[model samples]
Target chain A: MKKLINDVDAILGESLAGFARAHGDLVSLSQAPLFVRRRAVTPAGQVALISGGGSGHEPLHAGFVGRGMLHAACPGQVFTSPTPDQMLAAAEAVDSGAGVLFIVKNYEGDVMNFEMAAEMAPCATARVLTNDDVAVENSSYTTGRRGVAGTVVVEKMLGAAAETGMDLATLQALGERVNGATRSMGCALTSCTVPAAGGPTFEIGEAEMEMGVGIHGEPGRRRVALASASAIVEEMMGAILADLGAAKGEDVLLLVNGFGATPLMELYLVYDEAARRVEAAGLTVARSLVGNWCTSLDMAGCSLTVTRLDAETTGLWDAPVHTPALRWGC
Target chain B: MSNTLVLRLIEGMAGTIESHADQLTRLDQAIGDGDHGINMARGFKELAAQKAAIAALPLGEALKKAGMTLVMKVGGASGPLYGTLFIDMGKATPEAAPTLADLSVMLDAGIRGVKARGKAEVGMKTMLDVLCPVADTLRSLVDQNETDGLDERIIAAAGHALHRTTDMVAKRGRASFLGERSKGHLDPGACSSALLIGAVVGVLAPSSAR
Candidate 1:
């Protein structure tokens, strides 16, 4: 209940405004709180990449908006899906005659709203659904695996592919390739509080942890007695790797993502162990991203996303990118 | 239902959702992410804002506009689901004032819309648990020529169905995440739908009508 904010009602708007002010050089907020896009729209021939979900997963759909990433991001309230209108508006603003690609996470509301938007939008629109979380399939709020940190990977790969002047169909196909190759699993030390709700979404005992946790505090596979950080990472990696089936000597993209409240100190600890395990499994870690790329608002946990990489995907991951969160070879 | 009756029912439903906002949030907190009440209140507030504009319109157009308003403003699972209800009902409704049989057809269309949008059926601990039964009761009453106290019967059936959600397992939405843990808590969507049906019955079935 005690965090930095002026009021509960203004949290999303004020925070977005502050983000716009701080990163005005990189991106601009729309007249409404629904979306944020690059300060300058994408180049004329590049396909537009749009992704969105409920707010609270910061630096996600928004921070990724820039030269080689997302063209636009539609954010909803904390953990609530954005309306179709917002997605439509974002689509209209960013579609550059190359058609638009919606990189939707596989939540029921997110899917439904995005689908509605796609149907209503006048331009040619296609969707690439990311459902890389290896947690319980068909868990609450979705028909299949939930989209977790794999979204960050999908966005980056597709964003780079778009910047390469790929057509909407090609970008959409590349997006599906990345999503299909990725798998993520998370474990939570504590639950998160949605600002409007004024309390934690769920309760966990002091000596217990949630396994295979979804970002929105959805029930994981099971709860067990708390264990050491290394032990937890091993278990999480085991689940992800078992599902991934990466071949020996394969190059892969790895993401050690924080679920909002988890700090870098622990994320590094996770990355250290994750890198070692990937290497131990005879797979080469081609590229790595470590930070809170996707989150669930003040929840204490981290998720591990592993994408078995092909030569094209690996090269795209290294593509020059200029965004607030991920800026490098630009 | 007459256009005036439809307008009055919408107003009453808005008022009821506003008043019970906190209760809905509390119910959601137990199993879901705890924003059902907030989203519903925001959506109904928008619907209420359209009262003057929709009051004079035909029933189908007015209800359709109401659905669009909720879809644009609510921005959550409930927005599209409830919006589908009104929109489908509007499409199914005749241009003229609807008789009880016509209302039954409208409700049938609305419930089907919910099923299509949410992919949920009755006994899945969703709004359909209450809405489907009400639709059935309306059709049965019409078939039997038992129109006396029809609104009362609809409300009572809806209430009973709403209560039944407490014993059922959630198979949709955020509550479904809880699995067995979702049991014993009343589904918030069902609660809101029941309140909406009750408000309509309150307007359409005064004691004199009974």
Candidate 2:
């Protein structure tokens, strides 16, 4: 609550404004909030790439809105999907002559809103929802589980394709390809606070932890009164590995993301264990990225995303991409 | 009945939730992931901002917006349920100015929406169990001119329902995961929601009583 703000009520709006202000060098958009873009957007020719969702998952949907990434990202309220109206605005703002490719993560609202946006987008919409990303289950309480950590990778890969002048149709297929290849599962040790609440979003006892936790802290698949760091990583990795049907000699890219509150030490520890397990499974770790790449506001947890790499994921991974969160070889 | 009264009711509820969220979270910690207090407070804070959205909107629309806002602004299980309830409430009243009786109707609609979405029911130790009785009793009392303006009786009823929650076994929700261990702790959903109702009632009471 006290970190940085003039008004708690205006935090989301203000943050959006601030994001546009600070990152103006790399990103820009129309007067409307939904209209978003990379600074050097081509208003003609290339198929525009667009992605958006709730605001809290920073560097996602927005921070990824620069070169080789999203053409526009409609930032919604935290953990909520952008409205159809916003999506339409973003679609219009970022539409290049060819069309627009929407890289949607598979959360209920995201799916529904994107569907509406596609029906209404100025450019013909090419939609790809990240269902293969999360290894969680839908619950009676939730419309569906959620699209979590893997979205970052999906957007990155697809955005790179769009930048390479891939047609909207091809970009959409590539986006699907990325989603299909990625498998992720998260675990939470503690909860993070919503800035307005000034308290934790959820609580986990000193000894308890939730497994397969959704990005929004949706009641995870299960919980255990915590175990060693290795054990936690083992469980999460096992889920991702099994979901991918990853077998011996498979090559994969590993991403170990901290859930905000966790420090680098723990993130690396989890990554270390993940590496060991992947190697033990006879899988080759092509590349690895670890740290708080995606977060839930200081929620003391981590997630593991294993992309069973094929030629496409590897090519996109090596693409000259520059986003706020992932910048290298550009 | 008046906007000022309604504002005060909201204020009271906000205060109680702000002050006592930890208690609710503690309850959740036992059976759930411990977000009851945090989720409700976040939902209400967003609720406060929607006064503008709700101002010209019909009661049902206002309720729906509040619910949708909760779902969008808040995360976790309660977010969508509470968010959907308000949305359904708004859909129910559409263009009508909901009276106190309509408020009961709204709550009933909300309960139904939550149940339909969550598959939760009374005595399952979810919010619906406590809310069902409260909303029904309030509507029944509307004819009796008994339940209005956040009175002590309503507060007591909510509290009674909340306390009674401890006696019921959790048939669903995260608490069900705990099985027998869930009996002793309060139903986090009911407790926090009652605190909301009770807080409003506290505000509506006579200043002299305070």
Candidate 3:
């Protein structure tokens, strides 16, 4: 229940205002219908990339809005999807005649709202749906896998491709290709509280953990007795590798992402274990990232993502990029 | 019906959602993320604030305005799904007072819009679980020319439909992530839908029935 905020209603606006001010040089904020756009819009011939979801997963959609990444980001209420109008406004602001591409997570609300935005958009539009979370079983009887930390990978690689003046269709295709090669799984040591809800989304005992948890604190595979970091990484990596069907000598990018409350010390420990596991499984770790790139709100946990990589994708991953939350070789 | 009735329905639904917000959040906490109540309440409160302005318009326009409010304010799966319901209903309804048959048509249109938007259907442990049955009851009542106690029948049908969600496995939304765990709990979206229907019908029903 304790949070550093003026009011529950003002949380998103106030936080966004601070973000816009702190990164004013890199991005601009629009409040009438809230969205963040790059201060420097993509060149007229380059396709614009937009992605969004509920708030509380800070430094995500919004932080990624800058050069060589998302052209804009539409943030919603805490853990709630942004409205279609936000998406449309972002599209209008950032679309440079090369059309717009929506990088959507595979959540129900995110999917539906983005779909509506696409249908109502004025310019040519396409979508790249990321469902890289291997925690849930994908079936006609379910909503399929969620898009979690692996979304960062899709956005970064596609952002580079877009920067290279890739056509809308090719960027969209590359997005899908990258997403299909990524797999992620997470376990939560505790639950997160949505500000308006005024309480934790779920309760976990001190000695227990929720395996395969989603970014929103949605129930994962199951609750089980807490285990060591090595054991946890093994279980999560097993699910991810089995689902990804990664083969020997294949190059991969390993990401160890922390939930909001998790510290870097622990995240790096996870990276250490995850990296060793990948090497033991005969996959070459060509690139690596470790941080809180995507997160649940102050939840104590982390997720591991492995992206099967090739020459083209690796080159894109290495491309110079500058964003508030992610920057390399810029 | 009349613009007055539309205003009353909006106000009543908003009040009901506010009162039941805690219950809805608790239900969602069990199988989904625990924000359904807060999200629905925020949207309805905004709609209620504009009820007068919205109700000043013609019947169809009023409903459409109300639906747009939900779409803009409520930022979850429910917002667009429920917004589509009201918007499509508004699209189908005429400016003139709608007959029972006309109401049935409007409900069906709304239901179809929800189905298409969510890519969902009845028996999926969603709001459609309650909404579809209520739509069917309205259609049947229109066919039978049974106007007496119409609101009572609709409320009863919605209650029954909402109850059925407790045993039905979810196939959409965050609840679907739970798989089998999603069963054995009421769908929060269905609960809110039934509550709104009850509140609206309770006020809109003829005074004589009460």
Model 2 chain B lDDT-worst window of ten:
B201-210
TM-score of each model, paired residue for residue: 0.96, 0.64, 0.95
Q: Quick one: best DockQ, which candidate?
A: 3
lDDT of 3 by residue, A75-146 (tens): 988888999999999999999999999999998899989988998899999999999998888899878889
For candidate 2, lDDT tens digit of each residue in A1-330?
Answer: 346778766887777777788877888756544556778856567888888776677767678777777778887666655666677777777777788777777664566556656755667888887764344554453334356778888887887777677887788777777777888888888876776656666667888888877676656667788889888888888777877887789789999888777889988888889999999989999988887766886688889988888787788877877766677886
Candidate 2: residue A168 lDDT (0-100) = 78
Per-model CA lDDT versus the true structure: 0.88, 0.72, 0.91
Cα lDDT tens digits, model 3, B1-210, are: 666787888888899999999999889878887778978998999999999999888888888888888988888898898899999999999767988898899999999999999989889999999999999999998899998888888988998999999999889988887667788999999999999888878787745222
Question: Where is model 3 more than 4 Å wrong at Cα?
Answer: B208-210
Interface RMSD of each: 2.5, 6.5, 0.9
Q: Candidate 1 lDDT, tens digit per residue, B1-210? A: 455776787788899999999999889878877778889999999888888787777888887889888888877788888888998999998977788889899999988998998888888889999999889999999999999878778878987899999999888887776778899999999999998888777777766221
Clashing pairs in 3: none
Q: Candidate 3: DockQ? A: 0.77
First chain of candidate 2, TM-score: 0.93
TM-score computed on alpha carbons, candidate 3? 0.95
Q: Fraction of true contacts reproduced, model 1?
A: 0.50
Candidate 2 local lDDT, B38-150, one digit each (tens): 76777678667656555445444555666666765545556666666667767667354567777777677877888776666787888876778788678778878874454
Report per-candidate TM-score of chain A alone. Answer: 0.97, 0.93, 0.99
For model 1, the chain A TM-score is 0.97
